[model samples]
Target: MLDDITGKVMVLENHNGQQLEQQPQQQQALQTPKSGVRRSTRISRPLERYSPSLYYLLLTDSGEPECYEEAVQVETRKKWEQAMKEEMDSLAHNQTWDLVRFPAGKTTLQNKCVYRLKEEYGGRKRYKARLVVKGFAQKKG
Candidate 1:
């Protein structure tokens, strides 16, 4: 029945007439011609200049508050306050710090609230506020 088959057929056998499994053929690597010339696949085109108005339309400023006083004075003051409250609640829930008295002769570090406008899916904006300590003020012990 095997003799009726056409094309190249690999056959492996042992002394006991048991057929051995054949390994798969390895693929050949693509080789360039002897001239060593490589064909350019990309087409070169003239660069198009864009107008400044297009950039202004695409990249709108976030207009987030830079400081706490500015945050409270902005039109989105309620949103910024809510965000700050949420941040404080999260820090308290995580037990990030404990209330303690200031150490004598030790300078206290200053903290500031940073605000940002986070854009969500479908053009929705979310207010985000983070409390950051001024670590640079700390002196090396």
Candidate 2:
């Protein structure tokens, strides 16, 4: 039996001349529409009609990796690795940091890799990677 209000399927069984109602194992509760609330059938303008490029942008997914480990695990591992390499090269060229031995009594700050997918004006996607230090861990000078 189909319930009109809840839209749930109810199973009715007769056992020993007694009728029993049994509900399905998996049941989902649906909200019942209020009275005098009719659904609209109006059609609005399509996104492609207004701007095809915007429609394409909306459909495209920016599959950017979250971390360094995830970046190497995805299908575009080479691209992500290249982006990381480029970022490291740029940092080295600009003398961003110096490699030094850790001090015995001081704690070292950790760093994280951030990835972004930038879309150019012509819809070309650019994979960018940035290495940032955790500044919140730093102490006052």
Candidate 3:
């Protein structure tokens, strides 16, 4: 069954795969008035919507490989290599970092390439690669 509340349709299914009807309170709210004009539970006002960058925090992709080795094991090694090369080229073009000699008693941060498949709704998939510094390795200043 489909319930329309606040102009949004919500479809709920029971454990037995049967659609569930709306609760009595929801039904009463949807009841029409005796007046000539019908009352609607549907919301006519515009809603406030926002897409935050932290949306990824709520999602976890089990299919995604965690590390470069795992990525190579799952996806085509050639594709990962091409993606890495592209990322490196972009970093170089942007001059993202510079090589420097490590000071004595100071630790140098390690870096790794993170690879993932990015896909848009009804759009083509893309292989993305990014180099991330191991920030935890940095010494407290």
Instruction: Give the candidate number with the greatest lDDT.
Output: 2
lDDT by residue for model 3 over 24-121, one digit each (tens)? Answer: 56434666657676689887764434344344543334455568877677646777778889999999999998988878986677999877888878
Candidate closest to the true structure, highest TM-score: 1
Q: Any idea what lDDT model 3 has? A: 0.74
Candidate 3 or 2, higher lDDT: 2
Q: How well does candidate 3 score on lDDT at residue 128?
A: 81
Which lDDT tens digits does candidate 1 get at residues 1-141? 132367556688989999987666576998976786689989976454476766565544557877898889888899999999999999999999999998989888899998889899999999999999999999899
For TM-score, candidate 1 versus 3, the one ahead is 1
- Superposed by TM-score, candidate 1 places the C-alpha of residue 16 at a distance from the truth, in angstroms, of 99
RMSD of each: 15.0, 19.8, 26.0
Give a tens-digit lDDT track for model 2, residues 99-130.
99988998888999999988999999888999
- The full ranking of all candidates by lDDT, starting with the best, is 2, 1, 3
**Each model's TM-score, in the order given?**
0.56, 0.54, 0.49
- In model 3, the clashing pairs are none
Q: Can you tell me which runs of candidate 2 are displaced by over 4 Å?
A: 1-62
Error of 1 at 38 (Å): 59
